[model samples]
Target: MNKPEKIVAEDLSEAVTYPPEAFISREYAEAEPDKLWSKVWQQAGRVEELKAVGDYITYNICHDSILIVRDTPETLKAYHNVCTHRGRRLVGNNTGGGPKTVAQDKGAHSARGSQMKFGCNYHAWTFDLAGDAIYIPDKEDWQGALDNVCTSLTPVQVDTWGGWIWINMDLDAGPLREWLEPVASLIDPFEFEKMRYRFRYWGIFDCNWKVALEAFLEPYHVQGTHPQLIKYGDFYSFSKAFGFHGQTGFDSKAHRDAGTAVETSVHRAAGDGDPRTTIAQMQAEYWETIGASTSETLVKTAQRLPLELPEGTPAGEVHQYWMKIAKEADAARGVTWPDLSDAQVAAAGLALSIFPNVNFIPGPTFSLAYRVRPWGTDPDKCIFEAVALDRFGEGEEPETEWTFVEQDLDKWPYVIAQDISNMVEMQRGYKSRGFKGNLPNPWQERKVTNLHRGLAHFMGTGHLKRID
Candidate 1:
C-alpha cells in the first residue's frame, strides 16, 4: 500500500538495542543452545514419514537424534536415537525401520499405517515400535533380573497437526498446541491435509539462523535481496507482531493484489516477436512457447474479459486449470514460482515459521516443510531435513520422489545459501571486538525482535523485559 519510512538511527536507539546483527553471531547461538532449544517446542517429522506400520524416521535435534516410529495407525512414538548398549546412533540409514503391521489400507485417500517393533543396529538392543525396550542381547551376563530391569527407549512428548509430528524436550512443559498457538492460527486456514509434500532444497547460509529466518519473515528486502521478485512481486508494506508463541509477518493486501497482475512490459512484448497483441496475447504466446499454462482467468482480470465456462466445469477442476494458467504465465515471463507440485499449491503457498526451528510451507498443490535441529548444541549450524508430502490413492506411490528436488534456487538462492554461512559467521561475530551492539529497525525488523524477546522470555532472561 504505502512505503514504510526507514526510521533514523536516533529513533531506533530509543526503541530496541537488539540490533539485526545480534541474530547473526556464533557466540549468541552457542551460549544457550539447551536454554533455547530444550525449553521450547521442536518439530520432529511429518505423519507421512511413518506412512506404514514399523515405518519410522530418525530425527536429530540439538544434542539429540530421536527415532520416530508409527507402531500403528493410531499409535505413534518418538525415542532417543542412541543405542542402549554401546550407545551408537540407532537407525543410521534413512529408510531403516520395523515391520509394517502397524498400519492398514482402510480405503483410498485414508490416513492409515502400522509398525511392529524397533531394534538398535549397534548391538541389536530391540524395543517395541512404541519405544519400550523389549529385548536385551545377553542371556546370563549379570543376573536373572535383566528382563525386569531393562526398558524401552526414552520417549519424547509429541503432538500432531496438518500431518506433522511436533516434539518437545521439556517433560514438564505446556501442551504442543498451546505453544503452537502463535503460528497455528496464522497458517491453519490452508487445510494442509489436502496437499502433498514436494521435494525440499536446502543450503547452509553465510548468515546466522535468525538472519536466514528474518529474510523470509518480511517483504521489505524483496527490493534488494531478491530484485527479480520485485518485477511481478510487491514489497510495499508489512504486518508485523508478536504471536503467542512465535512472530508473525506478512505483505499488505495491495502487494498481494499487485502480484497477481502481469507486468506491462511483458504485455508489450506479445506483438513484437510473434505478431500478437495485448497482455493476454503475450502471455498466451509465452505459455505455448514454454509449454506452460495461459488460462484466460489467471491473467489479471483487469486486463481482459472474464471467461465464463459452461456449468459442467467442476469447481475444483476450474481452480486447478486457472492456477496452471497463472503458473505458466509466471514461467513464460521468468517469474519466480513456488517450486511445488499441483497438490502443494492447492494445500496453500502459506508457510509457518514456528518460533524456535520449524517452518511449514504449504504450497498450492504441495508443501515444503522442515525442522532445523541444532548441530551438537550449536544453534548456528543445524541439521536440516525437509519432508515433501503428496497424497496418492490406494496401491499408488510416486514413481520418483520429488521432495528432495531443489527448484526454487533462482528466486531465493542467496538467502538459502547465506543461512548456514551467516550462522557460522555470526557465531564468530558474537565475540568480535568491533561488535559494539545491535539496533533493530523496529517497523521492518519487529518479528526478529519478537523472536529475541520470546527466547528471552521462555528462558527466564530479564533482558527482554520491555515486553513485560
Candidate 2:
C-alpha cells in the first residue's frame, strides 16, 4: 500500500511574512488589557487550593495581581492585591493568612468566624474578607476620622464550577456560566473532583504563548515535531471549532479498538506509594464504562475521536471533570492492567478548548491543561504553559514511565526536559527575519485555522483581515 501522505498543512511562509512585530509588539500587549483580560473570564485555580475560611490565592491576569479569598464555604470573592491605605501589595506569594494575629475592630465581631478583616502590612489598615474596610489603626491619632467606605479591598468578580474557581477581571462582564454555557456539559463527566494533583512542571519558551498553545491543539505535528508520537500512533485528520470562552479540537482517529492486546504495566518506582481506594473505585467504575486497554490503544482511540458532543454546545466544564474520573479509573486499573473487561462501560477523555487561551485535553491516563496568553500579535512570542496531571490508580502512586515511538527527546516532551527545549527555541524563532507564514494542509490545519478565527473574533477584526 502507498504510504499515507504527510500533512504539511500549515503555510509557515505566509504566517512568518506577517510582520513578527505584530505579535511581539509591546503596544499590542498593553492595548485593551482590561478588555482582553476582564471582558472574558479566566480560570483562577482549583477551589480546594483555598479550602480554609480565610484561605486565598494570588493570580496575575493582564499584569494585575488579584487576591481571591473564600468568604463562605461555597462562595469565593476576589480583590485587588493592592492595599487601599499604602497601595502596597496586600497578599504576597501563592496563598497565606493575614498574620499571626487578626485584629478585630469596629462593628465587626472579632469572634473569628466570617467578620475577620484584612490588615495592611505597612500601616495596618484593616479590611474585611469581603473586601470591606473595617478599621484604621490609631483612628484618634490620625484625625479621629478615617474613611471606612473607601478602604475596602477593591472587589473583583468570581465564580466556581467543577470544584475550580474562575475570576473575571471585568466586573462588568456577565456571569461566567453565561460565557461557559457553550462548552460546559461537553466536559463535565470526568469527575475532576476526585483527581489528585499528580505533579506540576513549568517551561519558559522563547516563543509566544500562542505558539505553545497551538502546538498542542492539534496532532498535525505528531509526525514531524513529535516523530516518536508519529511512530507509536497514526495521525487522523484534525477537526476544531470555537465557542464563547474557548476552543475545541482533536485528531480524527487512531484506528485502535479498546479490546486490542497492547497492555503493558506501569513500572514500580521507589517511593511511589500505593494507589487510593476511592480513586481505584472511581477507575473501576470508569473501566466499566470504556473497557480496559494499554495507554497506547487508549490514546490512539482518544486522538481519533471528536468530543462526543456537537459543535458549539455548552457544558459546565464536562471535559476536565470527566478527566479527573478517567485518570482515576486508569490509575486504579493500572496503566497496563487488563482487569478492565467490560468493554461496554469505559469512560475516556473528551478534550475541549476554551477560546483565546485554554486547551483542555483530557486523556484516559492523564490530562493536559494549557493557557495561551498572548505576548504579542505576531502570535509567535506569547507565553504558553502546559500542566500535565498524570493520574495513577487509587491505592498507591507508582513510578510512572513515558513510552513513545522514537527515543528522540525533542519529538516527545512527555518526559519534561524535551518539552522545554523545543518551547524555548520556538519562541526565539518567532522573531526570525526570514519568516513567512506557511500553508496548512486542510486535513491537519483545522485546529490552527479554528484558533485563528477565534482570535480574529475577539480582536473584533473582520475574518478576512486575519493575518493567518
Candidate 3:
C-alpha cells in the first residue's frame, strides 16, 4: 500500500564496491555457510508441494539439508534432514508425500493417506513427523544416552508467507516477514499463493553462485546478452533497491512508447499486417530456434495486444486497454484476476532480486523464479534452480518435478542460455591477470551493487573500497 524507499542512481553511486575475489575465492565460499546462509532465512519450497498432512520436501543449502513437512492441516514444521545416529540423509528424494521411508527404492512413493515417520536406512533409527525420536535400534547399548539428549531432529526455525516455505538455521533469526520487509508487503497483493508450479529445472553452473545470481539482477545486460529482446521492447530499465531486495523493469507506458518504432520486435502500426500474426511467428521462432520455453498465458497475453490503437492514444490508455482484454481472457478461463493498480499492472514483466540468492521475473499470469547457491566449497561451481509458476484455471492439474538439464549453453532456453554464456565467460574474466574488480553503471546496475552491499554487510566485511 505504501511506496517503499527508493534507491536511485545517485544512491547507487554512493554505495560500496565489491572485489573480484568475493566471487573467485574458495575461502569466501566456505565462509558463506556460517556467515550468510545460516543466519538468513531462505525459501525452501512452495506450500503447494506439501499441501497434504504427510507431504514433505527437502531443501539443501551448502552443507545443510532441511526437511520441511506439513505437520497438520494448518501447521508446517522443519527439521535437520540428518539421522540422529549416523547423519544419513532422512529424505534422499527432493520431495515426496506421506511418511518418510527407509527403503532405498521408495524414492518416488507418494504420501497420500500414509502416516508420517522417517527411518534412517543405514540404521533402523526412526523419528515421527514432529521430529520426536520414537525408536532407536539397540537402545540398551547406549545406556540411556538418548534419554538426556534432545534427540528430535534438530529443529530449524520455519515459517510460511506468500505460499512459500522458508527456513532459518539460526534459531534466533528474525521472522520471515521481518527479514523480507517491504518486499513481502509490496508483493502480497499479487496473491502468489494462488499460483501453482508449472515446472522446475536445475543445473550445475560452472561459476560461482554470486556470478550466476548477479546475472539476473538487472536488465542492463539484456541488450548485449539477450539481443533478440531488443526487437520486442526497450532494454532501458528503472531500478529500485530497498535494503536487501530490489527490482528493475521498464514501466508499461515507457515500454509501450519505446516499442512504437518498427524496429521494436513486437510493436507495429495498424497497417503492418495482423499483430497476432507477427506475434505468433515470433513466438514460434523463439521456441524453436532460440530454445526458450513459452507459456500459454504469455502467448495469449501477447497475442491479444491491440496493434492499432487510436492515433495519439496515451501509453497509459493503451496499457489499460490491454489489461481490460487480459482480465476478460482470465475470466473466460475461470481464473480470478487480482485487482491491481496502474503501477502494479505496469510492473507485470518486472524482474526482482531478493538478497542472498533468489531472483524472479514476474508476470501477471506467470513468473519464472530462480535460486542459486554455492555447491559445497567449490568457488567455480554452483547449483542453479529455476521454477516456473503460473495461475491456472480451476481443476487444472500441473506436474511438478525437477528437470535436470545439461549445463551447456545450447541446452538452456534462449533467454537463460544467453545469461549463462556470459556467466561462464565472466568467471574466466575474473580470474584474468589484467582484471581488477566490478565497476557497474550506477543507474543500470544498481541492483547488483545493492546485492553486493547486502552480501558485504552479511559477511561483516564492511563496504568494499573502490579499486580506482
Candidate 4:
C-alpha cells in the first residue's frame, strides 16, 4: 500500500471532493476485498458471545466467510469457514439473504453452534474446534492421497480488544492494538470490556457502506438534517485527523473561533438560556430519539434536576451535580464506573471513525457503536449494524441477541431513522448530473476526507478525484 498524501483542513477547497463514483461505482466496490478488507483488522463479534469452549461465530465480508471459535478456555481460533472437500460453507451458506437463500439454508443445512467438532455432513469429514482435521470419512481408500495433505483449516490472525473479537485475513498484519492507535488510547479509559450489550440493531440499507458511516461522522448536519435537535443545544462541530483515524465532536464557539485545541465531547450542551435545563432536555431527547448514547439513569436524573436544585444554578454546578447523583445511583446498583480523568473523557469525544468501517461514541458507563459492511459486491447496498453497550452490575447483565429489523424508517429509533433517510437520498443523488461531488466541511468533516484518503492509500491510488 502506498502512503496517502496528507490533505489537512487547510488544503481543502470545494474542489477537494469525493466523486459520486467513490460511493456508487461497481468497479470500486469490487476491489474492496483485496485493497481494504484483507488489509485491515475487522471486528467479528463480542467476547461475551463466546464464553464457552466450542462456541463460534461466522463473519462475512464481501464473498469471504471467517469462522471464529473458542477452542479452549483460554484459546480462540479463526479459519476459512469453508469445507476443503467441495468448498461448501461449514456453517449455513451466508448468501447475503433472500427468501430463496433462507429456504436453502434451513434445517440440516443451516447452523451456528457450540460443538466439540464441526462435522461436515458432506461425506462426514469432521474437524475439532482447534481447526485440526481429527476425522475423515474414508481412512484406507485414499491413504496416500490423504497422508501428505495438511488438513488443518486455513488460519487467520485473531485477537481481542474492547471485548470485541477482531480477525485479520492478512496473516502478517500488525497487531490490533497498534492498528487501533491513539483512537484506542483515547477511548480505553471508558473500560468497554466491562460493559454488556444493551441492544443490537441491523438492517439492509440502500446506500454504500461508507455513506451510512459518514452520516454519523460529524454533527455538521444537525441543523439541516435534525433541526428539531438544535433547540436543545448548539451542534457546531470541530473535526480533526488522528493519523490513520479521525474524530468529530461538538465544540464551543469560543474554542472554534480562538483556534484552540478542541475538547468538548462529554461537555454539557449550553445555549443562551439556562444551560442546566438545556442539557437536561438534551439528555431526555437523546433517550427518546436514539434510545442509546446516554444512560437511562442519567436521563432520569436530568429529568428530576429542576426539582433537585434551585433555579439559576451555575452550569458547572448543574453538570457536577447531575454527574454526582447519577454516579451515586449507579454505585448503589453496583454498576462500577471507570475512573476516567476529565481530559481523557473529553478527548474520547462524540465519536471516532475507525479506518475502513467502524464508528463509536464512548461514555463513562454507556456507549453506542456502528459497523458497516458491503452486501456482496454491490456499491448501492450494504448491511448496517448498531450496538448499545452499558455498564451493569456483576451477573446482572441482561441477555441480548442480535436482532434484525426491516428497513422501514419506523422500525428504527427516530434519530437513526432520520439518518437512514439521508443515506437513501444521498445514494440516489449520486445519479444527478448537476451535482459534481461532496463539498465537505473541512473543519467539521475532516474525518470524511481522512477516511477517503485511507481508502485511496490502501487501494494504491492517488485521490479518487481531481478538480482539473
lDDT for 138 (candidate 1): 76
Clashes (backbone N, CA, C under 3 Å), per candidate, total 57, 89, 4, 0
Error of 2 at 416 (Å): 5.4
TM-score-based ranking, best first? 4, 3, 1, 2
Residue 395 CA error for candidate 4 (Å)?
A: 2.2
The C-alpha lDDT values of all candidates are 0.48, 0.48, 0.69, 0.79
Select the stronger candidate by lDDT from 2 and 4.
4
Tell me each candidate's TM-score.
0.64, 0.64, 0.84, 0.92
lDDT of 4 by residue, 107-185 (tens): 2211356878887767777788878778877666875676424677788999999888899999999899999988999
Query: How far in Å is the alpha carbon of 60 misplaced in model 1?
Result: 0.9
Top of the candidates by TM-score: 4
Q: What TM-score would you give candidate 1 relative to the actual structure?
A: 0.64
- Backbone clash pairs for candidate 4 read none
Candidate 1 regions exceeding 4 Å error are 1-14, 19-33, 93-115, 144-150, 205-207, 242-352, 360-371, 378-380, 383-432, 459-468
lDDT of 2 by residue, 1-468 (tens): 112123222332222112333245455455536446657777766666776778776765444667788887878888877888778666543111111133322111001123245667788877778787677776677674556666677888888865567888777888877777656654454444444445333332455665566666655555665454333334443343434333323232552333111111110000112222222232333233222211322333233213443433222222323333445555546643222322211222224667667766543344557665643233334444444454445665543221222223443334333344566566567567766543444444555555654444455431322233
Instruction: Report the Cα lDDT for candidate 3.
Output: 0.69
Winning candidate number (lDDT): 4
Score candidate 1 by lDDT: 0.48
